[model samples]
Target: MPRLQGVDIPTDRPTAVSLTYLYGVGPKTARELCLKAGVDPVARARELTEDEVARLAALLDKDYTVEGQLRRQVTQNISRLRDIACYRGIRHRRGLPVRGQRTKTNARTRKGPKKTVAGKKGVKDLR
Candidate 1:
């Protein structure tokens, strides 16, 4: 196993495909990182030398706000919404659908499992 950017990379898979396991890295970003670090995209992660891993990490650190930084930015955005008490923030706080999707029928995944309440006489039950 080779470690890059504090992540243990799978050596058995192609570098380009395997590097996606790292936070904030996708296929396209992995390819670009490999190119910038002078590593072959098709090379196995385990086969990389220490210098290669160091170079790759350095390159990514220099050029990208990845992993913790990116996660923090997203958290900050949500925090700002909460601070402002916006409608979207309230929706997020309630853990309900925020995009105006029809919740009367669908959105069970967000709303959790349906709980049926007993209906009054002559009233149809709505699940």
Candidate 2:
């Protein structure tokens, strides 16, 4: 495993693909990073020299917020939204879909399991 931005990238994979193991980096970003760092995108991570690893790590640290830092930034954004009490923030506060998806039917993921309530008993039942 190759460590980049505190994440373990699989050594068997190409550097381009392995870079995506870091949070906030997708395939496109990975390729771009490899190009910027002068690393061979197709080369396996295990084949990288120490100098190459140092260059890649430096490039990422200088230009990107990833891993735990990225996660904290995202959580802070959400918390800020909630503190403002906007519609989307309210949705987040309620744990409902934030993008205006119809909750009346198919929001099971956010709404969780249905809670059944017993119907009112009728007078006829006493007869």
Candidate 3:
């Protein structure tokens, strides 16, 4: 496996496809990166030489924000929503859907499980 930007590249796949394993990097970005670094997109990750890896890493570091930078940006986006205190912010705080989707039916992933309540008449007298 070739390591780039502290990530293990999948050696069995083509460079263009394998590079997508890195956070925030997709197929297009991977192809562009390989081109910018003078790497062959069709080559397998394990075929890359040490110098090629170094070149690719340098090019990526210069042109893109990966790993920690990407993570921080995502965190900042969520934090900004919370700081704004808008309807969306309230939804985020409450762990509910923020995109105006109807909660009467689906959206189980975001709304979680429903609470069951027994009807008043269903209760029997213990005395």
TM-score of each: 0.78, 0.80, 0.79
lDDT of 1 by residue, 81-120 (tens): 8789999888877777878877788659777876555664
Poorest lDDT segment (10 consecutive residues) of candidate 3: 114-123
Candidate 3 lDDT by residue in tens digits, 4-117: 878888999999999999998999999999998899999988899999899988988888998878999988988789899988888888777888987888659778887555
lDDT of 2: 0.89
Model 2 residue 37 distance off true place after TM-score fit, in angstroms: 0.9
Instruction: Determine the backbone clash count of candidate 2.
Output: 0
How would you encode candidate 2's per-residue C-alpha lDDT over 40-97 as one tens digit per residue?
Answer: 9999999999999999999888998888889999999999999999998899987788
TM-score rank order: 2, 3, 1
What lDDT would candidate 3 get against the real structure? 0.87
At residue 119, give the lDDT of candidate 2: 94
Candidate 2 TM-score versus the reference: 0.80
* Error at 98, model 2, angstroms: 0.9
lDDT of 1 at 38: 91
Model 3, stretches more than 4 Å misplaced?
110-127
Measured by TM-score, how close is model 1 to the native structure? 0.78
At residue 112, what lDDT does model 3 achieve? 82
* Global lDDT scores for all candidate models: 0.84, 0.89, 0.87
Ten-residue region with minimum lDDT total, candidate 1: 114-123
